[model samples]
Target: MDELAAFLRTRRARVLPETVGIPTDARRRVSGLRREEVAHLSGVSVDYYVRLEQGRARQPSAQVLDALARALGLDGVEREHLHRLAHRPAHAPRRASAARPRPELLRVLDLVADAPAFLIDHRMTVLAANRLADLLYGRRLQGLNIARHVFLSEEGRALFADWEACTLDTVGHLRLSAGHHPDDPELAALIGELAMRSDRFRRLWVRADVRTRTHGRKTYQHPSVGPLEVHQENFALPDATGTELVVQSAAPGTAAHDNLRLLASLGATPAPSAGGGCPAEGGDRGGALPEEVA
Candidate 1:
């Protein structure tokens, strides 16, 4: 199926008629607004809407796109996605060069000191991390790609207290990344690998969800600490395209905060049988940042 067509179909299928002020009737066979309905709401002819959905019409004017977005109730990210699908080039753009977080940015990440902070690129590859993050993520942080780890690894599956929610966020964020960088070969390879290896990833990938992991509260089931909850904030690095610094923090006086301190005191050595150790004291694990997962 054409990517644009499929995306439109999925979005259309999700908007219930009643929710959009169209009174529901059992006579309706389709789940969402009919093509003619959408075209009417979007101020276009039914044939034009049909052509768009059938992939016979690839281009739509900005006004029409905006109208469709309104009719579909698309959010900012989804609206941007609609525009991208409509405006994408005939040939995929060149893949971007390998990204690197600046040394200064790494220094800033380390300065977070009390919390877990790490830098990641558009693909969610761990580029650099602070001491606390090293202690927190341990081996999981090494050569880690967040989406790959969460979907393809056993440890990742067990890391989040709410793995299902995490999976949705991971998939949605990756979808947004694909929208932004459609031609990124590494990302395409990663997505293909996950699709082939993980049933869950494949299922979620087709949903066309789009989101960014900007800020949220996440609960981690740290093997050593039991249950740990943190507020994660993502800040896009200045002068860096497709790179962001993610910091995870716990509220003061909470058990999570105390657990964080305990983890720090334990240093690079993980609790017995808990699995994975942090970076060696005084420096990282004798390797460069942004280790690629094979």
Candidate 2:
């Protein structure tokens, strides 16, 4: 409930009165819409809304939550987060499931031969990567918590052209994952370690940003291929919860595309067999490689 209150307050602070069709006054001193305004917009009593924000109210009905979501102008991800925080039960924490890319999913990863594609679990652990992805990431990121690598490792920091923007997105990704699996001890530990080690991560974590950015353009400073800008797309694996396939590609005939081709040629090898060892086993020796890569 405390998390719910914080999330609501932060979201409310971001929305301006005029943007929501509430007329603004020059003399208004509030940073955002006042409690009464939010209550009126959400079709609830002012006292009830205050209780919700103060963590004194119990679980709000879905209808009221929906109304509040509208009043606060939340996106799909943010709205879902709001509901989770509000409705989460006060129960014992449960262990998070182990992350493993299914064999079929690994096959899907290998199908994208021209682009770099990899599988990541909710904790940002790199579960698998195709040959091109292996070469693109220089095998440094396999089986590593990507958020930790970005904030704590020199090589990881050097991989991105826009390090700050990339880290901010990483923080938001972790925050979203945390909200979904609050009982996940490994996820909690990862967050705690990063918070202790990286001041940049700490600052971003406090902003209460929640998002699952699906598609965007990103620039990578590949050690072997130089700078390459590519379009990144994230696809959720339907059969597997808390897993996603990320593919990055550049438009044909562009320098980035040429660089990708060069990278492929540089590390071109026989595609791993469908039932071989895990594709990302190069740097990760903590566990036996799954027999899904050659």
The total of clashing pairs for model 1 equals: 0
For all predicted structures, in order, the TM-scores are 0.88, 0.85
Q: How does each model score on lDDT?
A: 0.78, 0.80
Q: Roughly what TM-score does model 1 have, to 2 decimal places?
A: 0.88
| Model 2 CA lDDT for position 188 | 88
Best-fitting candidate, scored by TM-score: 1
Candidate 2 C-alpha lDDT tens digits along 13-81: 888999989888788898888989999998999999999989999899999999999999998988898
| Inter-residue clash pairs, candidate 1 | none
Query: Which segments of candidate 1 are over 4 A away from where they belong?
Result: 268-294
Write down the worst ten-residue block by lDDT for model 1.
Answer: 273-282
